[model samples]
Target: MAISGVSIFVVGIALLVSVPLSQQNEEVHLKFSYSGETGPDKWGSLKPEFSTCSTGKLQSPVNIVTKDVIYNPKLQPLNRDYRTSNSTLINHGYSIGLFYGSDKVGVMIHDGKNYTLKQVHWHSPSEHTINGIRYPLELHQVHIADDGSISVVGVLYNYGAPDLLLLQIKSKLDELAKEACGEDEIAKIPIGHMGTKYLRRGAFKYYRYVGSLTTPPCTQNVTWTIIAKVREVSKEQIEALTAPLEGSCKSNSRPVQALYGRKIELYNAMPNKI
Candidate 1:
């Protein structure tokens, strides 16, 4: 089994979790994909608004080089306040997403700013690599601040035991994927309340940086926190997550972009232990 950088990307016909922030803007994605003419390289030319895809100085999904990382003693551990809340898993045509509705799922505090946890989405083959290693799956917990700035908590995963949360939602996920292809809807498939155990469990090293959404508009200034604790997920679980989406989403993950001299900061919840 590979170690180093990994986090939980949960899925199932059996437990918990599903899809990305980019899926939220179905309009923009309707014109883009992971390959071919509308691929990452041509995202900017697809539309006038997508110019940032080619022009932005600060982009996301950069490979995190450990040796080049600077430890920031001043950086604080991510303060997460989460819980089991009423949730729904939906298909976004190009992606599948697990979203919280009506109820407050919770929030996380970084640099004294509080962002509400909105939804959790998965990206296969992991987006942000560590030491040039890309894991099997990645989960991005999207949070939005009052001013609408986005902060994402990323979980990279390697194979292990099945996640219970995914096991609980497997049937609903399958049902939606089978019926919801090419539809843009929010939380229509209620899977009841889900736990926040994965987010709160254990102590791990996390990397912090300023970047953009991995998806289009390719919006910058998004804060990214990638937890270094790799979580367990089974192969069966992986298939359950991807069964719904079509096209670029089938193997959705943008190619790693250049760092452009951006500084990557490392934070350890248990100092000096990792």
Candidate 2:
């Protein structure tokens, strides 16, 4: 669900991006761009493993038609038991990723399954849209279950007051941006005891759906949970997040994909429950 759209984002307020712990998963080394021959349109054919990118019935980064969203009472609040972990910040040429080094950082309990937290990443101009509007930034909290199933909790951000999460790592991002442009070495910052709570922005309400991985090898059956409330982020914060990827141009968002009969459900949390 990494960014790749055509329009300059318009935040009427509503998101996603995920850079995996391994560079291979983010496909950073892959020859895919937001446009041109190796762009999103050509992802499925770039390699045999990426065939799902073109053929998957339920591709991600779908526009959430709020009116059509079925309010599922059974849907539960997002339960993430994240902790402080020894983490590494890697500036993959295409994205900035925060990776957990421990056996597990934490887990989110959904449908009684514990999806272990893996990594978090950002995408500019947002990937998912709300009511046909796109936000300035999106943060993805990616997790996986014992059976290899995936669950991503997304938080969308708009231009406003600075995000504390970005504030903490701004300087590091600036340094990484220079390293990414240099091409001699990948910037790997060993930031100790980083916690994932910084990613928990927005309201308790969220929209849930079954979708594919936003990036290539576009795996299917991944669960997506997008926070309903939009968080505040300043333009400077957005700039810091995208700086490391300036070599590839500022736009990294993937355009919204066809819904293909997939159902989007909203989890309206009970008062004081979330």
Candidate 3:
């Protein structure tokens, strides 16, 4: 598929030019947190490489206003082919993540290119908001194209009945929260079935844009598709996911960044007036 910009690696290098040789070579151990001295506000100053976090025009997790979206008939429906695979859960000091094996590939076709599923991660209280409304939880399925381009499919969750797919990993989440802080503990969770079922559900639509990663080294090569449909997850499930990371990582979401006049496209399966 024809992605619209320079490779992310190139962008990183371009941004790094502003750093001095001494600071560039110095082993800077900057710890980024949800709040405090090392919070998002200080990310750009923390590390020379993360300058984009403070200055990039295409930063992500914007407050998506429906009134600003353009209904695009040309935007194709997401074509996902995910298989059940052996997955591992990790507590990365900031957020919890479920990783898939490199060999076990699942692909999502967007803009005519296949981006392979890499890992899934969560942000409590969500990062992206719809009409200034933040959901209780947000699930990000991170994918990468063969050429190193990134595409993330974001699903938002509200409080209601528990999601079956989330339930499949609930126990693992609890264990990781209590025992796996700052460790890459692999939970023996089979995620293929749950992931497939969740992605294949009908009546879902998405808003597409080109934005940056929510975290530091906030690369701006992402093709973001935020699912317009909000799913349900019980309050208990929300607690199960957040309780463990309470003290050290209470909230790992970034604040909404400026949109900078970037156009967001809403893709609907059925034709409807905007």
Candidate 4:
């Protein structure tokens, strides 16, 4: 089943009011970064809660080699329910994120489980690579299950014509980029539409693996589905995404982690397959 765009907008508004501003403000000072003392390598040491960054064996952003992937006909096509919604643009210090309102909910169905969309964020010089080749940008749509498990659907962007969704938020991004850190006023954005465009039209082929969050806490048991087909975004869009992060960190991506013998399943579209 699919969700309507108007329903998504209403839910987003509900979520925004449910969360108090004070609580969100308090979380803005965690002090993590992409380089120097607070870099990825130092994440575990900076805070006790972030120890997983250095110690976790199942870390994410691994290099995906096509030759090493096992074809899985059983993997189901993603059932995405999304729509345009009001969103807030935040400069999280480490990366830029577009967050949905607290009451809003979008879901992705896979293997009989449902993961609700929470927010969308970007990383430059793409963290996950295809056969060791990194793209100009990467987009991550973060989702959560009722049990709080996380699943991130990743899309890599190559240089090309501008993306309509990116263009819609370009002005807000530029404004946020000017400030070192903080959030802009809430704006209505077609987030669900943006996500749908990528997930629905692309080659259904994707690489799946279990890994930890790319950020601190580095919590494990996260599911990742990275679309094999690349998407297009303009050079200007790439600049808008990365410019804000340039002053503090050389790059916003974690170096590709070791596969650690983890098996990667390539979900291929086959007739009469699940």
Clashes of each: 14, 8, 1, 4
Q: Quick one: best lDDT, which candidate? A: 2
* Regions more than 4 Å wrong, model 3: 1-30, 180-195, 246-248
Give candidate 2's total backbone clashes.
Answer: 8
Give the Cα-based TM-score of candidate 4 against the true structure: 0.82
- Native-to-model Cα distance after best TM-score fit, residue 131 in candidate 1, in Å: 0.7
- Model 1, runs deviating above 4 Å: 1-29, 183-187
User: Which stretches of model 4 miss by more than 4 angstroms?
Assistant: 1-28, 180-203, 270-274
Q: lDDT of all the models against the reference?
A: 0.72, 0.73, 0.72, 0.70
- Tell me the TM-score of each prediction against the true structure: 0.85, 0.85, 0.83, 0.82
Q: Weakest 10 consecutive residues, lDDT, candidate 1?
A: 9-18
lDDT of 2 by residue, 198-268 (tens): 76543478999999788776777889999988999999888887776644446778889999888999888
List model 3 lDDT by residue over 62-178, tens digit each: 999998898888988888888776677655456666766545458988789998776777888999999999999999888876677788889999989998877888777766656
TM-score of candidate 1 relative to the true fold = 0.85
Candidate 4 lDDT over 28-111, as tens digits, reads: 224566778877889889778778888888998899988889888789898887765566665544566777766544688887
Which tens-of-lDDT digit does each residue in 1-274 have in candidate 1? 1111211111221011112433443222235667788788998897786688899978889899888888888888777899899887765544567778757788888888888888887888788999999888888888887667788888888899987767878888767755634333322487787778776665458888898887766878888888877787888888888776665568878888888889999887666664
1 against 3, candidate with superior TM-score = 1
Q: Considering lDDT, which of the candidate structures 1 and 4 is the better prediction for this target?
A: 1
